[model samples]
Structure formats: structure tokens, C-alpha cells
Target: MTADGPADLSGLKIDRDAPPPETGRLRRVLLWGAVTVLALGGAVLAYRAANPASVPVAVARAEPLGGVPGAGATEILTANGYVVARQRASVSTEVAGRLNQLFVEEGSRVRKGQVLGVLQNADQKSALASAHAALASAEAREAEAAANARETSLARGRAQQLHAKGLVSQAELDQAVASDDVARARVKSAEAEVRSTAARVESAQVDYDKTFIRAPFAGAVLRKEAEVGEIVSPIPSSGGLTRGAIVTMANLATLEVEADVNEGYVSRVHEGMRAEITLDAYPDERFPGHVRQIVPTADRQKATVLVKVAFDRLDARVLPEMGIKTSFLADSPATGSAAGTTAVAAAVAIPKRAVREADGRAVVYVVEGGRAVMRGVSPRPLAGDRVAVSAGLAPGELVIVEAPSTLGDKSRVRVK
Candidate 1:
């Protein structure tokens, strides 16, 4: 209601298009902040790409310590080895021949003296038959010779009686006695012939039996080297077609781990020392064992000694020639408890750097699915470099060593 014509509103409504100074300043500040944030984010990404966090794998694992299979064992030494049978044999024919039949296959369980395969033995059978006939003929001749001797003795007696009664001359009685002596000598020769024939028969029978391949001991068949119609020989043949063995069988009951230990470290191992065996096929399973024997000889080229370790108990999954790893345990003397039982504390010794103290408890970072997972463990002071964990951890689990401060539970990590 200004009567000075709606135009006298001077100085109040002059700049309708100009932006406020404070608003512009505020926008500039926000723009710069956003740019700074983007720049910092890009820098962080580049840094991460160049330098990724890495963690070393922990070597500690729960395993059998001694005597019996249990957890929390300390591994003193580790070696790669193979499962071997103490009583392994390659069954073959004594004489070279074409295999006629096979009685066993791979993984077949057999007993000692059980026939595993048979070779073609028609010729051997025929020879044995001939020997039997010859033996029979010789026996018949021996009987005939004995009958002649009896007749000759009777005649000699008759002649002697006649001579004593002066019914015959001395020359006649002498001739009869000489004839009896000849017959007795013939009988002895026939008996010798019969024995010789019987021996020949026995030899023939042996030859026939040699065609059958028998297991040397109770074991499991690992491989079949020969098939029907294939030639098998006890000795290696010059040709490739002939098989040197019929079947390769091993006494599974005698399964043991054969590890090649470094000559320098062999001194630390001895017979009856407790050991833990792990097969590649069954990595999580631990088999308690003991040192069976150390080979007297060392490999000159490898500079290693062969050590055989026997299982505390056998498992059906343990087979000959399987890849395995062995851990030799330090000997811990058994102590008698108040209950009159042996009390032994089996503890897993891990590198001290791998363990972290959190919330006044021992914690270890284990790798699972490419992530670091924390596990609480009961720890005790072991040696200078290690801590003994009495609980919480399993054999063959990958643990992160010297975990980074940034590592948290379920954090993504790369193990080196």
C-alpha cells in the first residue's frame, strides 16, 4: 500500500539473479572435501594393490605324542616317506611258462601257500604220468626178482639136502648156491632201480607244482603283473613281453612307514622311539607308531638313512607304497600317578610368535577358507621359541604365524 507508485521499493529488491556469498563458499568447501575424499580413497586402493598383507603358515599341529594315538603331540622332526610292507614279495613262477589262469586280482586278500595263479602245465602232467608208469614197471620188476630169488633159495636147499644124503655131488650143490647168489644180487639191483624211479617221480611232481604261483605269506595283492596267456618268469627276460613277476603282493598286516631321514638328523632317532604317521590320502588322520628299525646302510648319493616305523595299530586304509609323512616325537618318560596309572601330558608345541594374548587368554589365528579365524588355546611355556598348546587345534590345520595387528576374526587373509 505504498502510494508512491509500487516503484519506490528501492534497495530491497535489486539483485534477483546473484547467488549468496556464504552459499557459494559453502558449496566450494563441500566440493573440495568430496574431491579430497575421492583422492584419498584412490590412494588407499593403489597402496593395497601394491602391498598386500601376508601371513606365514604355522607349523604346529595336534598329533599323537607317544605310545598310544591321541592329540596334542609335539613333533620333533618331520620327513616325507612311503607306506611299505615289511613282508612284501613279488610272486612269480619258478619256471618260465605261459600263464593259464589267475586266481587273484588287485587288492585280493590271500593266505600263505594259497595259489594265486597257474601256468600251463600239460607237458609237466604228461612227464609226471610217464614217471609214474616207469615207477610202476620198476616195482613190478622188483617183485619178479624177489620171486626168482625165493625159488632159487628153495632149489639150493633141496640140492644141499640131496648132497648131504650123498644123492648129489659137490659140483651140483655149488652150482645151485651160485645161482641163488646171482638171483639175490639181481633182486638188490632191481630194488635200487625202483628207488631211482620213485625219486624221478617225486621230481616230476615238484616240477608240476612249480607251475602254480603261491603266495609267500598272508597279504594283500597290490598289482597283477601277468594275465592269462602272458609269459611269466622268475628272472627278468630280455624281451619286454615276459613278466618277471606274476603278482606283486604285500603283507598289509606288516604295514610300516619307511622314511628317509637325513644322515645328520638320524642320530636323533632310535628304535622304539614314538612316532606319528600321516598318509597323503588321509591327511587329517594320525596313526601312532614307533621306530621299527633303521637300515644299516646309507644311500651314498642321497646321504640319507632309511628308517622304518611300525604302526601302534593297523588300519585297513593303510596300504603298501602309499605316500606318507612321519613325525618323530621326543621321548617323554612315563610318570606314575597316584591312581597307579601313567600320567603323561601331551602338548602341541607351536612357535611363540604364532600365539597372541587377547583378553588375557591365549589366541591363535588359523586360516580357513582364505580367512583368519581366531581360536582360543590353553598354552604353557615350552622352550624359548615355542609355546605348548594343550587344547584347541587339530592336526593339519593351517595356522597363521606372527599375525598382523590388523588381523581380526574372520578377516580376509592370504597365507604364504
Candidate 2:
């Protein structure tokens, strides 16, 4: 039987295709794990794409008002305005002519009576010369007439003497008197002509003076309206190229702010009210000012009244037509410097919009290292649209004023 079953291979069949059961299970598990990881990663990416991680927000700094004592009284009202010069003029010539010379340029400072420009003077000069020549001729004629009158008076005297002596007829004496009278009348007529010619000369001189455009007041030139060779007119001309003004000038010393107060809040502002003016161009600097006047009329369309605010001390930095913000105060800004010092010491203020409610507590999103740091603050109502931060805010920290509703603590924000 052992011989018959020679080299039976059934018990030892070669099976190279089959793997170990444990190894097969391990490979299936690894494949499924990789697929599950990829699906989860795709879901995470979609969710992130749907909801951005960083939000854009408008932010404002938590400003410390150096201790504004009675800030409430100090800033009773706020209004937007623009700086304007009380003495502003667009200087033009009295006569229309081609501009021959431009003495001043834009931004040039000029003194009163300074020659700013000159019109073409050839015609004017000619007219003036003609008038002078006429005046001279009239003077010469007047001199000649006076000489003739004197000669006639002497001749009449001689004739009377002769008549008295019975050496001349009565008719001869009468003719001599008539001749004298006629000569005197001719002299008078010549005198009148001289006066008329003198008046013409004066008129011509005035016309000649009109050719030079002079500054009415000392000021800084804001704009150059006409260049040399451009025509300038005293009155507006039909052609657009004819400029009515050679230059627009403003007295920098007379720079003031003209604010528009809402009619509803106009009652809060009054003449001589102290104010703090802030220029948009110079945000860090605050200029002291006072309400100079409240316009009698109101703008029907804007529902606002114009208020003039004059700076207490003029600064060269101040300019006409600059955007400005004014805060009307209760006391006079000129009383003393101490009042300003006190105002600077009183409070740290931030826009009311910066304070947001979080978990039933008043909190502010302070920006630090490009991330929003939620700080719980004890906010007290301050003047205008600001709140004083009694706690949890420093003077220079930036706070988010307008943020998305979903903004949370530690949220990354892009400040606008």
C-alpha cells in the first residue's frame, strides 16, 4: 500500500495565490480607514468654504479723553461741518481783456493791494495817452485864451483914454468895448473846454487802473483760474474759456468751520458755545473753537441749520473747505487752559457701537495681535454716541465697532 501511494501530493498541494487570513483582514481595514479619512477631510473643507473663518468688521480705537471733567457738559452736541474762510474772494478784473501777466500762482500768499494779474493794456494805454494829449492841448488853448483876454482889456483901456481926450469918436469907443467883451467870453469858453478835457483824463486814468488786478485783502491763493494769455472778465462771459476770476483766494487767518446741526438738536447749540473742532485731515489734533453764529435760516431739504464756529487760535494747518467735526461744549474754551486739562483727565471713551452684548454681559471686542479679544467692560453712558469705559479698556486699544453677529471671542477679524 505504501508503494501504491507513491509520492501522493494531495496532502501537500502548492497554494501560492491565497494570503494569510489575518493579513487580508488588515488590508481591508486599512483601505476603509483611508477612504473614511478622505471623506471626512472633504466635508471639513466644504464647511470651511461655506463659512469663512475670518470676518470683516469696522473698528474704532478706545480713546482716552485725557480726563474730560464734565464731558457730558463739555460735549452737548456734535455736528459735521467744513472749514471755510470768512474772507474769501475770487478776484477778477474790472475790465475784460486778455491776461497779459499773472503775478500770483496757486498757493501763493499775497498782501492786500498786491498785483495779482494784469490784463492786456495796449488799448488802455493808448486811450490814456490820447486823453493826456487832449488835456495838454486844452491847457495850451486855455493859456492862449487868457493871453488874448489880457491884451483886449489893455486895448479897451487905451481906447477909453483916447475917447476921453476927444481924439476918437464915441462909436470907436463902443466898438472897442464890444471887442473886449467878445474876447472875454471866448476865454471863458476855452476854460470850460479845459475842464471837460480834464474830466476825460480822469476817466481814462481810472480805466487804465482797471487793467491791473490787485488783491483786495491779504490771503493765500487757493486756485489759479486764469493763466497768462487766457481772457478774464469782470462779469461772466458767454464763452467758457473767459474766466471771471483770475484767482480764488482765502484769508487763512479767518478760517472757520461751518457746521450743520440737525434742527431737532439746534437748541443745544448757541452762539459763543465752546467747541472742539477736529479736522479729518488731522485726526490726532484738536483745535479749540466757539460757535460764532447760528444762521437765521434753515435748509429745507437737509432739515438742518448752519452754525459758524470760529477757531480760538488760528493755525496754519487749518485750511478752507476741509472736513471737520465739532463738539459743542457748555463753557467757553477761552476761560483758561485748566479747563482743557480737566477735560482730558475725566474719561476713556469709545463709540457706543463698540460695546456688544455677550452672554448677558456687556463686552467689547478689543483687537490684539490681529485677533479679537473679548473684554467685559463696565460701560457708562457718555456724551454723544460714545460710552465711557470704566473698566477693562485702555486708552489706545482698538475695538471693533461694527462686527458680524456671529463674531465670538478670539475670532479672527479683518479690520475695515
Candidate 3:
């Protein structure tokens, strides 16, 4: 076996010149294709980052000015304000005590004299019971005194007759007459005590009634200020352990807009002026309104006059404290009829930021079908941070506010 043991070992060696197996070649091609595809995908993502398909933008709707949008009335003034309830109150108990029960919650509609809550009245109940017992005892004493007085009267009469017949001594007759007088006095004293006890019972009843917290007027409860087991008081406590109000309620029927008009322009608005109101919560809705009152006083610090505007017809959607924009309409022939007092003009306004300057021309990026469309606008400066658009936009159309410089026509957008 000696010299031939490793014979023909060279023939078993691999041929580097030969092509790889079909499976190996297929796997290598696939790996290279995957790497190339991944590289292309990375490059595409980088390009997209530099040039976004859509832009993030702040937007505001083109709102009407002066009155209901497109109502075609002259707008005398524009003011921003909040809805307020003229008749609002924070109801509380007359006496301070731990809250025992609650019959209402936030948004609960309650009627006048309806029990809203109750305070722990165990002590008050005990006092009332005691007063009733005292009254009963006093009344019983009065009855006893009356009986004794009758008996004494009879005895006195008998003694008088006896004295007249000379059957009894003068001393015995005098004693009987004195007894009658004493008994009558006792009856009078007992009557006074009974009256005093009755008054005490009434006092106790008043104290007991105070434990129930009742609504002062019919209204919607805006907030439940006190919870069960919390101490409530008529007066606010400095220590903060007691709540000063059980609930805060407002008369929704008395909902009105309280706007502050610039003193410089106050003359343009007056009581009974026709107006249009748009609430921030319901921006698309135009509510007919009138100037209910022009507050006689002016705010010295703000240089503004408070104006109260009342809705011509109340809506269920209207709520207290909602932000609102009001257009005070000037008297015009269109609104001359008594029923046309709520007429408004056809004018539009938008936030000042919504209008942009492009090539010395005013432009705005209006959103349509999720795309920005640049349009020219004719803007007139208004009293506040708003501009009246005489052209190029319609009420309820959304325009990009403070749009980025990179944003262009036909750029996709998503409302924030």
C-alpha cells in the first residue's frame, strides 16, 4: 500500500475554471437585486423628505363681515365677544353644613323651588322635635290652668251664697274669692307660655327648611360646585375647606352676546341696531340678532364700550360663554321694514394672517379638495386682526393661515 496510498488525489481537486452550480448563481443574482432595490428605495425616501407631497398648514374660514354672510346689508361695525347668561347665579345654602344628598348634576335642568341638594339636618330635626314637645307641654298646662280657674269660680260663687245665708264666716268667703283671682292669673300666664312655645316651634321649622337647597329660578345647571359630604356655605370660607356654592346655573333663555366695541367706533353701534352673529363653535351658522343694549359705561383701560346683543330667535345650539363675532349693521333701506330689522350686508372677512402678499399682490391659499389653490384677494384693513375681503373668496371657504413659504398651488394638505 506504500507509495500508492494517496494515488490520484489531484483528480479529486475542484476545477476553479468551471462555472458555479445553477442554484448558487440564482441565489447570488437574487441577493444583488435585493441590495439594489433597497438602495433605490432609500434614495427615493431622501428625495421625498426634501420635497413633501403635502404640507401642514393652519387654516381659517373666510367669514362674513357686518352681518350674516351674503345678506347684502351695510356693516357699521365688527366686534368679538362671548355669549353670556344675563341671569346667572351660584346657588348655595343659607346655613353651612356637610352636604348630605344631591339631586342635580352639571347640565341638569331644574325648576324654581326644586330641591337641588340637601344638607345634613339631624340636629335641626332634633331641635324641631324638642320644640314640638315643649309646645305640647305648654298647651297641656294652659288647659290645666283653665280647669282650675273654673273650679275656683264655682267655689267662689258657692261661698258668696253661703255668706249671704250667714252659713259661712266672712274669712271663708274672702279666701274663696281670692282663690278664684289667683287661678285666673295662672291661666293668663299659661296662655303666654303657650304662645312663646308656638313661636319657638316656628323658629325651629325655619331652621329645618334652610337645610334644603332649592333653585332660585328655572335654569340649566352649568356646574356642580359642591359634592356630597363637602361642606357648603352661603359665604366663602378663607380656609378653603368649605364650598361657597352648590351649583352654578344660568338661564339659557337669557343667552346674549357681550362684545366690547372700540370706543372710537362706538358711535356706529346703537341699541336696536340689526346685527349678525357667528359663533366660533358653529362658524357656518349665521344667527340674526339685535343690539339689546349699549352699555352706558365704557372701559377706561381698554378704551372699549361693552355692547349687549340679543338673539332674535334662540337656538338650542347656543350656549353661554361661546366665543362669537358680531357684525353691527347700519340702518339701510333694505332693512326699513319692521320685520327686516335683522338684515345684513354681503361682505366677507378673514383672519389677517390668511391673506398673503405675492409679487406686490394680495394672495391667499384656499383649500379645496385637500389641495391648496392660490387666489388673489382684495383686502381692506378692519378694526382688529382681520381684513375685509371685497373680492376673491366666499363665505365658508377655508384659507390657509400663515402658510409656509414653500407651500404652493396644488399642494396636498391635511387639516389640523
Predicted model with the maximum TM-score = 1
- TM-scores of the models, in the given order? 0.64, 0.63, 0.63
Note the Cα lDDT for every prediction shown.
Answer: 0.82, 0.84, 0.87
- Which candidate comes out best when scored by lDDT? 3
Residues 99-166, candidate 2: write the lDDT tens digits.
99998877999999999988899887999999999999999988998898899899899999999999
Error of 3 at 406 (Å): 56
For all predictions, the C-alpha RMSD in Å is: 21.4, 20.2, 16.5
Deviating ranges (above 4 Å) for candidate 3: 1-72, 333-416
**lDDT, candidate 3, 1-416, per-residue tens:** 36758556667887889976697889999999999999999999999876667778889988765443334666767999999999999999999999999999889999999999999999999999999999999999999999999999999999999999999999999999999999999999999999999999999999999999999999999999999999999987899999999999999999999999999999888788888788998775567789999989999999999999998768788888999999888644454666656433456778888887889999999999888999998776543467777667778899899656888888888777
| Model 1 lDDT per residue over 326-411, tens place | 98987555677788867465546566677887899889987888777889997654323555566676556766775457778877
lDDT of 1 at 186: 94
Clashes (N, CA, C under 3 Å) per candidate: 0, 9, 4
